[model samples]
Target: MELTFLGTGAGRPSRLRNVTSAALKLPAPSLSVWLFDAGEGTQHRLLQTPIKLNRIDRIFITHLHGDHVFGLPGLLSTRAYDGGVGPVTIYGPAGLQQMVECLFQLSGTYIGYDIQYVEAVEGVIFDDGNYRVEAAALEHRIPCFGYRVIESPRPGRLDAGKLKEAGVPFGPLYGKLKAGEDITLPDGREIKSSDVTGACIPGRIVTILGDTKPCANAVRLAEHADLLVHEATFAAGLEEKAELYGHSTTVQAAEAAKRAGARKLVMTHFSSRYELEDAVQLVDEARAIFPQTEAAFDGAVFDIPCQC
Candidate 1:
């Protein structure tokens, strides 16, 4: 799995960065993209990358702020025009359906695919056997949410050599062994799966939060996350202003990652006042607290390695 930052600037677009949006690309057998937000010019950003609009199967909106959602209409319209006939599911807070429908009505836009809207609420929002997403209320001026994506653990690899040594031939039996099932040979010899399998591999955890100040929910959602993508809207010394605007400073974002025991952090949603070079200093401030912190910019990709 991997995450790509589409736009990292906060509030508005600048020469250095666009607005807020990110793409979480999952691996097969579900090779699809899930968007965290669709800020202004998001569809344009996707055009710059290899990701196709048709592969975007899910969109999770954190809030209704213009900077965070102004591009939704354009993206949805273009997806149909680009021949995306598959269903698209959107998860967001209350009034999301009404807002999107209102825009479609006013624009006389008709989509070729179905749109499913799920109202944001605390607890598990989506589960498809392989992965599950949990949503929690965050501390933002608006009713924003933070999402924790947990991948299901995979079965351990089968010991082919061990099975061969035990007189088990390669075939469907190997498949059963890999699935943690015991089987008996045609000669009536029994084989235990545990004796020929390695330990189960643990799944990865990724936490992505919307704009918010340092809060308990942010830490809770990021607990033990392999990657925590949080907003650092200001420099270290701008704590007062950050809190006033319901945003987080560089240091605060690091503190939340450290407190949550996250393996690494990528801070985004930077204030437009900071230039491209200023991202280095902002990241340095966060590194002082959590050494694994990184500053996210447009097209930045963070890959999550498998435990195996």
Candidate 2:
């Protein structure tokens, strides 16, 4: 899977960044896109990337803040205009359906595709066997949530050479062995699945959080995640202000990643006060605590490898 940032600024748009939005592009078999938050100009940002609005089958909103959801109505409308007929599922806090319906009613807009709304709840919100998404409440000014996307573990590749050496015929029996089933040969010998198969490759875990203060839920959602996207809305010196505004400072974000044992940390939702050049200092402060930290900007992309 690959993660693309549409907007990274906090509260409002800046010259270098927009607001808060990110997209996760899933690989083959389920070649679809999942969007996390849709701030203003989110559709415009999608237009710049290769992802189509139709490919976005699921959208998870973190909160009802203007910076997190102001562009949702526009994005849904444009998806219809762009000939997106596939069903779309949106997950968000309470009043999400009412808010969107109210906007559509006032604007006299119509959607051509089917839209499903799932009110945000603290637990496993979605599980399709292949992937599971868990949501947890976050410490923000208002209601906010953090999501953890976990991919299912995949079976290891079958060893055809080892099977051949073991006098097993290369046919449907190999398929059964690959499926973790024991097979009995015509010679009255039994072969275990683990005898030829390699170790299972573990799945990847990604945690994406909304604007939040340093809290336990944030660490819990990000625990041992392959990639953790957390908000660093302020620099180190502005810790008090960040906490007051229900946001995390650069140092605080890195500390969360460290506490959670996250493999990599990508900090977004930066304060507009920091210009492009100032990002170096902000990320440097974070890197002081957690070395595997990066500051996200608009159009930034991070590819999560599938292998364990």
Candidate 3:
């Protein structure tokens, strides 16, 4: 899995950053990508990267802010033009369905593929075979939500030596045994999978939050995450402004990561006033509290290692 920051600016676009958008790349059975917060110019940003628009299967929007949702209609229309055929599911707060419908009506745009819009509350919003996504309400001005993407634990690997010792021949039965099933030997003796398998490898957890202030919900959502992507819209000395604007400062985001026991902290959603050079200082401010902290910029990609 990997995370690519499409736009890292907050509120508006700047020369250094665009807006709030990101792509989570899941490299497994197929090259699947999930987009989070498709801000303005998100399709344009995706064009600049190696991401294919047709491969995006899911989109998660945090709120109804223009900076976070204005690019949806355009992206949907462009995907239709680009020959996208599969269904796409979008999860967001209440009113998302109405908002998309209104945009399509106003623009007279028609999509060719099936687009499923899900109005999400504070609970498990999506669950596939590999991952479970849960949302929690955050303290934002527009009922924003934070998402936790938890990967399911993988089955244990098969021990080839043990399998050979158990007289299990190399065939489809070996596949079944690797899948945690018992296999009967030629002599009718049953061999349990646990006896010939290694320890089950745990999956990684990634938590990404939308625009919000420093709240307990954010901390709880990010607890024990391998990667915590939180918005840091201000510098360290702007705590009062952060609270007033329903956003978090660099220090506050880092403090949340520290409190939640997150292994790594990635701060984005920076205000346009700060330049790219200023991001180093912002990262330093966050790292002062959480040692493994970094600031994300447009086009930045983190290649997460697979646990299995």
Candidate 4:
């Protein structure tokens, strides 16, 4: 799995930053891409990366803020033009379907592919065989949600040595045994899979939050996460402004990471008022409280190696 930041600016676009957008790439056997928050100019930002727009199968919007969803209509239309024949599912708070429908109606745009809109609530929103996504309401101006992405534990490795010791011939049967199936040998002896397999390894967990102030739900969503992507829209000294705007400060984001026991903190969605140097300072402030804090930049990519 990997995360690519397409835009990191909070409210509006600046020379140094764009609006909020991110892509989470999961490798095969599930070659899938997930998009979070398509802000203004997201389609333009995506053009800068090597990612194919047609590969995005799921999109999760945090809220109805202009900066968070302005690019949805254009991106969807472009996807249809680019020969995206597969179905795409979008999950967000209430009114998302109406908003997209209104945009299509106003523009007279017709899509060839099927699009499904799901109204997000506080619970498990999506669950496939390999991963599950859960959401919780955050304290924001609107009904914003933070997502917890948990990968399922992988199967154990095959013990070649044990198979050799048992005099089992190497073939498709080895694969079945490694898959935890009991097999009867040629001599009528039963071989148990657990005897020739190593222990199952656990997968990594990632948490991503939308715009919000310091709240219990943020901490809960980030609990024990391998990586916590939280919004840091203001510096430590601007706590009052952050609260007034229903956003989080650097210190507040750091405190949540520290309390949640997150291994790493990635801060994004910076306010336009902050310069490049000021953004560096904001990261430093968060790192002072939580050592593994980093501020995200446009087109920045982070590789997450498989824990198994």
Candidate lDDT (C-alpha), each: 0.94, 0.94, 0.91, 0.91
Model 4 per-residue lDDT tens digits across residues 243-301:
89999999999999999999899999998988878877888899899999988999999
Q: What digit string (tens of lDDT, one per residue) describes model 3 on residues 1-308?
A: 99999999999988778899999988677578999999899999999999998899999999999889988888988999877469899999999889888889898998999999888788898888789999999999988999999888777999999888888889998888877788898899999988999887788889999999989989999999999999999999999999999999999999999999999999999998898999899999998899899899999999777566
Clashing pairs in 4: none
Which model is ahead, 1 or 2, in terms of TM-score?
1
Name the regions of candidate 3 deviating beyond 4 angstroms. Answer: none
Off by over 4 Å in 1: 181-184, 189-192
For candidate 1, the 10 contiguous residues with the lowest summed lDDT are 77-86
lDDT value, candidate 4, whole model? 0.91
lDDT measured at residue 135 in model 2 versus the true structure, 0 to 100: 98
**Full-model lDDT, candidate 1:** 0.94
Clash pairs (backbone) in predicted model 1: none
lDDT of 3 at 132: 94
The residue-level lDDT of candidate 1 at 297 comes to 91
